[model samples]
Target: MDIFLIILAFVTLLIALVGSIVPALPGVPLAYLSLWLGRWSGYTPFSDTFMWIMAGVTLAVFLADYFLPPLIVKKLGGSKAATWGSILGMILGMIFTPIGMLLGMLLGAFLGEIMYAKRSGYMALKAAMGTFLGFLLGTGLKLLLCFYVLYELVSTWWATGFGGF
Candidate 1:
């Protein structure tokens, strides 16, 4: 049981780390899962309170992950269409390279806006730029969150032994 729990915790942390940059995985949630698994295995120096604290941080990161991109784009004069297009482009972008994904999102949003209102191609470009900026912001925040989770996991584990967190 201890070994199983230990393996689970490690794997969860690993995936969560990847989740930060990927945007497709549940990074924060996976961090929380690691904490939960640690508890179930056996509580340690970290305690439930500490777990909750980590959870709070994760929640903040989650908020940043979801909102900053769209918010940034909107601030840059992007409309709802551009925002939605950015998201769609991102999803499709994952199939291609990261650079491709970024460009695809920007172009997709811009083109989408232009298609909707042919006279606003310039404005559409602005909106697309906003969307790309948002994506970068979100990615940065997510990476930060992922690293924090890793630090917490490593420290907690160190303090508690292999099964300790």
Candidate 2:
């Protein structure tokens, strides 16, 4: 039974890692669930306080992922239309994944700037670049948090020896 629970926890963690990139999955929450399951399974390496702290961190990162791109677009002199386009593009881009998402955001911002904001080609390109940078920064932060959760899960599993090797 302990081994089964351990395997389940690991599976959840793996899903969380994938969720970090997939956008549709609630990555941090899933990671937290895995940790909670481990705790329920009698793994004692992570204290309740530690879990609470990680939960808070996860929530913050999740929320930040949504706002960062739009905030960055505005700061870089992008109009409201450009910001909305980036967001819509991001959502639609999820269908094609990675490359599609990247192109979608850049294209969205460029078109928004040209069609709605009436910006020159050079300015539109600059705004698009800013949107791209924001996207990268947000993704990097999420990956870091996901990796940290993965590390914690593995380390606790190793320390507890709950799987019986």
Please, what is the TM-score per model? 0.83, 0.87
Against the hidden true structure, what lDDT does model 2 obtain? 0.80
- The residue-level lDDT of candidate 1 at 140 comes to 78
User: Per-residue lDDT for 58 in model 1?
Assistant: 76
Residue pairs with colliding backbones in model 2 are none
Per-residue CA lDDT of model 1 for 73-105, tens digit only, reads 778777788877777787788788887778778
lDDT string, candidate 2, 1-165, tens digits: 666776788898888887777767887788888878777777636787998899899888888888887788888888877876776777788789788888888888888899999999988888898898888887787788878877877788778774567
The lDDT for every candidate, in the order shown, is 0.75, 0.80
Off by over 4 Å in 2: none
